[model samples]
Target: MPTIIMTKWPVKLDGSVRSKAMAFLQKLSHDDTTPGLHVEPIGGSADDRVRTGRVDQFWRAVMFRLDGNNERHYVIHGVWPHDDAITVARSVSLTVNPINGLPQIEAASPSVASAGATAPAPSALSSESAPAAISPAGSEPAAPSTPAQPAPPSEASPAPAPSEPLLVRLGRTRTELTDRLGLSADIADHALSAPNQDAITELAARHEGWIGMALIGLAVGESIESIVESLELDQPHPSSGSQEADLLEALRRPAARAQFSFIEDQEELRQVIDHGDFGAWRVFLHPMQRRYVEKSYSGPFRLSGGAGTGKTVVLVHRARALARRNPQARIVLTTFTTNLAGALRDGLAQLDARVPQVTGLGDEGIYVAGVDALASAVIRAAGADVGDAVRAVLGEDRSQPNGRTTSAGWREVLDGASTSLPPEIAHESFLAAEYALVVLPNRVTSEAGYRRVRRPGRGLALDRAKRDAVWSLIAAYRAQNRVEGTLDFAEAAAVAAAWLETAGSLADHVLVDEGQDLSPAHWQLLRAVVGDGPDDLFIAEDSHQRIYGPRTVLSRYGIKVVGRSQRLTLNYRTTAQNLRYAMSILEGADYVDLEEQPESTGYRSARSGPAPTIVPADSLSAELDEVAKQVGNWVSAGTEPSSIAVLAGDRFHCERLARGLAERGVAAAHVEREQPPKDRVAVMTMHRAKGTEFAKVVLADTGATSAERDRLESLDGSARADTELRRRSLTYVAATRARDELAVIQREGRRA
Candidate 1:
């Protein structure tokens, strides 16, 4: 029996040494004529050099010994650089039959003149003339005439293999397993030794069919079987289906289902105000509502509805749905005003616990902000140079004349010339216009811009005033940027859209709240962000509640209306009588009954509140007193302090009402166009009260014969505005602030 010892390579060898070693082995193997003739490397050019004390350096070597008698055992050493003949030098000698005390020795043959000449063929060597056996210590052993016998074969089987291991076949021309796996050869070797066979199998299965042929040479039988199994040529893992089920189960938790339910409720006429998981309930939407939740798609989607419908609710729901569907995508939620933005944020938060994560349209993912805020964000992201220019031209303290002139200059440069302006120039011009409009008062810029110049004293010159207004706008922009370090919601959305277009595609869906309130600019910006995709655009709005300003035209934007408009007509918050009263005031002859169902505990109107009083006040102060008295009574009757809102037709009336209520020891807070501070009773103008609801409401100045009513009806050009504003106000005032009671207070001198 021969013993074979395996050791690591001692030193890295160059290409020449490796080639020579291979050639020598081939020569030795060709000369041997036995089935199991072992050919191994001995210390030579290919051998690893190792330190052998102070005497010399030894080479790590391999020795082969053959048992069959007819086979020739050749010990070849040394690898030549080229075809140079190796000088057979006596460097190390071997000893044979040491135990038998037989002395044997061999000497290296001198270099032959024909160095590159091929050695004599194996057929030239006779069995009896084979080389004598030499021992490790350089002794030649005496040869015996008898032949050696063969050993019995072994009976051990290979180890059990992995269940689904990857199999790779090496290419004929290449020794690498990479040709087998279709991977780069370098990766193939390490990949085969990957710690997790299942992961490798899964990875391979991703490439499936072609892998079988590609990996043909590298796999043993067991590994091949595993690969076959992975290809689904065999049964799949028994646990696969269960694992899928587990994933679904994780997604269906209460938190996940909340948004879906909220959306369903909104669609079903439940009229549930901003309740439930706003984020999760949106996820439960049917295909139509879900469409709006998409981040990107064709738009011009119009969400038109009457007052008290869940338009804003749907918008928040859509946003939630979008966030849920695309956890990684960014979503921007913006409204026209800071107040609306805050309401949206609060409403969305109330809808889902995760809404907090989705709120605040920061520069980061999925955010809620106002228009100005969004614009600011856009300016900042465009880079400091553009941002500074915008700030300079739009700064409020810069004076009106200069700002307007600057704005006109930039607008003229950008408007029709946008195609020609470089990105930097376009950005600067946009900033100028944006700042101009943002900072200028409504009187100067008009709520929406077409073109306008200011008169000196009366206003600044058209171009000069525009420039000055632009400067004023820039001031506000700077303040927002420096103070809060955030863009207003509108600015944020525009910036976010720009960011998405540049950074990557927008989210899979986008949900806009208060869709009716979105401006043309906002819609345009959102359209740009969504781009062209299969994604959906969902907008929820009540046209009747267009109290803040003009609503964006959905039809003009190319959004096709699908199915009939979804109407949430049921009035869940008010009593049938209250709904009737409110509707009559709003719709007059056109009002239709809402048919509210009775509550199980039996309906009660604000714990025995008064039957709306008609007072005869001599003056505004007298009217204020009457209104204050009514509010005090509601509080005494056990209504929550925050439940009551003083509804007025105008800001002046709201101020008077707030003062009167305050003087009566009622701690009330005015609901401005922006967010209100916490802990105060609300005194909101009719226009600002659209989506909000309260426990009890006092609709003051409702007397038909009052001067206010006459003024409301008398203005020919303002008729539509008054009607819309009044109807919205009546609906908002009656629907909200009436969880239990609604009070209509009109001076006695005024006729019905």
Candidate 2:
């Protein structure tokens, strides 16, 4: 069978054109000789391989045809009118990136590439002709002979201030781009000519293949190695010793997979067409993301990136890849919340409907569940109930929660018991953190064990007397839960972990999403279920987006990804304008990943758009009124109503926004647990909005003070700082949910 590649799948189309394109691909894949297809060559094309096929009476498919001895490959570049199709085919040619040696679509004639002026002869730069433009590693870059002016403010300043030099971004020079990394002299000279970061971004927007990616990486202050890694330019091409990879062999690499996909069957082609750009990540992921999904690891592995970098997409694809690689392997895919786990399950199905999924802890297929749900499954698989588990932690008072967290029991104990603990430490946040991080994970049953236990990363220091007071409260809390026969999430997970340790491995591999939200006890439970070997655990998380869950060090929980962790630096979802807005939320905040190192890198979005709008409104009514107007404008501009979302900090505001939309004669639905229906606008809280995206988003604030945001202002010292950071992250999360446009309506009356 011939391979069908969707190169640069275009979403810009009318319904008629979209349908025609899909029909064209469907027929071309199954039988290329169909009468309507009319596949043939374009006479005046710069590249003779260029061909045009009939999509409809008015539309034509501009593509490249490669005929092999056994089969042919159809590479669809775009769908356009007849004249445009011929023009594009004539201008385009397939060639290899001189630096990375990856296949790319080049528009200039091969003569231009061959000329010694624009670039070197394929592999080597003219040794003595082009002077070395940089110094050795670990030293300040040598300045160009002619002094350069300072960069202007408002440039892409994610990495450093605009006052810094741009031609030598991240201190990388022409010699580094050409020799150490990979870039042709012409491209290297072009990047070095850019006046500032803004210029680099503008240059990236116009170019394709490795040129755009390499330029953006330079602007972001990415290291030479990271830029290579980010581009997946380091991928092993079949024609390694030659100038470039063969068309067929190049398609097999992650580099090619970023903009191209090989259709295996008709169903996949249909699904890819149906989802379009929304599902593009599944089919066209950057080589870096594909690396995380396809690469093998000695132990647990971690993948982190800022919002919209396709971490979840990688996780979903990795899950399917793992299942297909080992049919008999028992895999567990889990997260912190039930809603997120459900999202993962839906993602797996959307990725490939044939992925084998099972419910129990069976030694076959993949089991998708929340960590708590997995604990429940583990207990049941061991012929135990929730009430019977957690005996080690709760002792005689141990009981099952019916799957609900007994966290409230801690507050109840505080109200019932008497102590002089500090007000900050007396709060539920402090107490819960102590129990989950120190007590439960350490398995401290008595006050004596708690006193002897070391609190490694706990923010506050507890003296013996203070420890006694905390233990008294803990003892009372356990006593109440013991009598009620209820276990909080931490205790239940602890019990499950203990059981799994004794029962041996219950899962061959485990993949975790939103991993930053899980507690330490949850991590222990996860480690217990999976065997400790190759491909043991795969975690996808972004510390900047961690709105829920604790700050945990995975190595402390025995799931080490220290040397195995990698980050994706290019965002595929949010527009560059909105991405700058989203990143502004974390401007001064310090956040660390599961590895516990300060996040040092920044990500650049692939798309660019208008800057996000911020409206300051006095009342809930005014905010919603503006939101309604914005929604109307978006819909009138051809964006689907179902592709718009209104997000808030809490459920009350979400409901109010939904009601306000209704009063304004607009269709809107309140979303809580599940995704909203496709026919109406969806209104949901920021927390629930995670893992979801829309074409346009309106972040509206009602008069009600959110519990989480209120906590941020109410606390003091380190605790308050942490709460404020998470609050910033929540707004960042809601903002990034917008794929195209975003509007933030601040309720001045509520906070100001």
- What C-alpha lDDT values do all the predictions have? 0.40, 0.72
Q: In candidate 2, what residue range of length 10 has the lowest lDDT sum? A: 132-141
TM-score of each: 0.44, 0.85
Clashing pairs in 2: 386-400, 387-400, 397-482
Off by over 4 Å in 1: 1-304, 355-364, 384-508, 558-564, 588-618, 671-680, 703-737, 748-752
For candidate 1, give the lDDT of residue 229: 30
Clash total of candidate 1: 98
Residue 470, candidate 1: C-alpha displacement in angstroms: 20
True-vs-predicted CA distance for residue 694, candidate 2, Å: 2.1
Candidate 2 residues lying further than 4 Å off, grouped into runs, are: 97-100, 108-199, 206-208, 223-229, 232-245, 273-279, 385-389, 397-407, 702-716, 749-752
Candidate 2 lDDT over residue span 1-752, tens digit each:
55687765332455556667887888899888887789988887777877889988777887778775468888777666666566667777766555565666665643322111122132211111111111110001111111111212333334544564586645667888887556667667777777666566666655544556677787777788877766666744546442312676666666667666777788888776664431244576666777777888999999888877777777778888998898888989888788878877877775787788897786599899998988877777766543344666555545454445555777787787778987788877888888988999888988899999999878788999999999988888777776776677777788888777777878889999888888888999999999799999999888998888778899988998878888777876676777888887779889988989998547787666556777778776788898898877776655567778899878987888899899998899999987676778889999998877776788887233665456665554667777777878888888888766778777874651
